[model samples]
Target: MTSKPVIIVTGADLAPEALALLGDYEVAFAGRTPQAADLVALARKHNPVGMIVRYGSVTAEVMDAAPALKVISKHGTGTDTIDKAAAQARGITVTAAAGANAAAVAEHALALMLACAKSVVKLDARMHAGHWDKATHKSLELNGLTVGLIGLGAIGRRFARMCDAIGMRVIGFDPFAADLPDYIEAVPLDKIWEASDVISLQCPLTADNKEMVNAATLARCKPGVILINTARGGLIDEAALFQAVQSGRVAAAGLDSFAREPMSAPHIFQRQPGFVLSPHIGGVTSAAYVNMGVAAATNTVAVLNSVREPAVGQQ
Candidate 1:
């Protein structure tokens, strides 16, 4: 209704700081758990110039509905939820707030690693049940152990540094990464499986690497190895993971993301004590919320501004 161009935020909330940056534009929220239909309706209604994706998938259908949409900015690092190919074909740029929540995600990965290594959740549950485990409990010590990181991006590098600081030998596998740190020895995927006491996934999910951690890969890992994943759920095969945990091949697993998000109850992982799960909240910290929102808004504004700018030869 307003004269200003609209920017649609997929979620109901956006940080006030982020809002301040878009004072020239009208911001509309699609509400929480926005479905594809909701996005399509919003796009048709507002014909928004930009979209900030916080939750829900942005399909090709949604993009087709918004003729004025010039850019799609992800509130976080992952852009898998956005149909990038469609955006590219439509000449609509897609961007993400990369490294906006890196520290938060890395810290969460470390916490999960510690939790798995020390049996923290199991111990807590035992204590609450009026049982003592001091006599029989033997926690794994992280010091002097080897940690293999799957990705060496902002989150992976941060986690690698944390592991290195704790006297853990750090090995990483990222063919695309450059400027190797001395402490993190660059290695291949096979070497990581064979050498690591703990394996943490920090890569984005792609067609070639979907369900990369499968039965075959698990068999290559050392027995009783620990696993931590703060990345996409599709990186690991849930069935394979279940079997490994059941067979005691994997000592413990800490998972923040799942193949199907907002993961419903009655899931297989819930029944296993060896599995520690969180509802994809690795980057849900208050600080990360503000950081991601601000970054997303900044990227959105930049793209919009560039589009509005006059060409060098123009008046």
Candidate 2:
């Protein structure tokens, strides 16, 4: 029997199609919600040549445990959980399944915006309580409103197109993006805060922009501006967001991600009606799951293959 190399999947399972791609390799699971220590243990046991990160952080210690590890592929777009500096130092490649979950996340962002603008969840709760709020309730109309997007990558751009089709004027700020469609007007962060009726985040988390939507930035937003975050949770300071919503500085906020994952019970936001929360399910659709899994697997295989095989001219 041939001894196949190992690949660790830091989750329960991958799509059947994705798994089929790795028939020649042995796959090890680290379970859902794995911690850094769990990953280190698995790496040490499997001596994996690659890893597919679905949950938890991949620290330098985990890398050190897997002496043969050559690549780390993210199951989703965000790779903030991975220690990029350590990976680079050890010459281990890191990759993300970029654009695989773009449509799902973009649609979720739009859903949150509409839910906030229409007071969907609040009205439902009122109805469930046998109270009729139709007489006193007023919902904001989204047509002709300006929406400011923080990132204009694949997900952001997909969301922009949706807003445009809804008759919204789309303005965005992304210093790294260019050659955008005519429908999207490139603008500065100041303009995004000052002019937007709805502000949505679809960017990655980075050191320089941690808690970018803090009290100071929220203070600059237009009164009654609706906030939607389908991106990283750390992008917004939860405490500041709670206070803003409490003061009605922000009329409503729809959050799919939080600074802390698997948000603890009795969270402060749970008590606030102005805040609509989803447990980071923005990119968890059936289609996106398969897409992301396949993409991650493909990236892992490509990286491993490059290292396992020699150049064309080599003997």
State which candidate has the highest TM-score. 1
Report the Cα lDDT for residue 225, model 1: 95
In candidate 2 the C-alpha lDDT for residue 277 amounts to 93
Candidate 2 weakest lDDT stretch, 10 residues: 1-10
- The deviation in Å at residue 20 for candidate 1 is 0.5
CA lDDT, candidate 2, residue 50: 93
How many clashes (backbone N, Cα, C below 3 Å) per candidate?
0, 0
* Superposed Cα deviation of residue 311, candidate 1 (Å): 1.2
Give the whole-model CA lDDT for all candidates, comma-separated: 0.95, 0.94
Candidate 1 lDDT over 1-315, as tens digits, reads: 889999999999999999999999999999989999999999999999999999999999999999999999999999999999999999899999999999999999999999999999999999999999999999999999999999999999999999999999999999899997899999989998999999999999999999999999999999999999999999999999999999999999999999998886889999788998988999999999999999999999999999999999996
**What's the residue-level lDDT of 11 in candidate 1?**
97
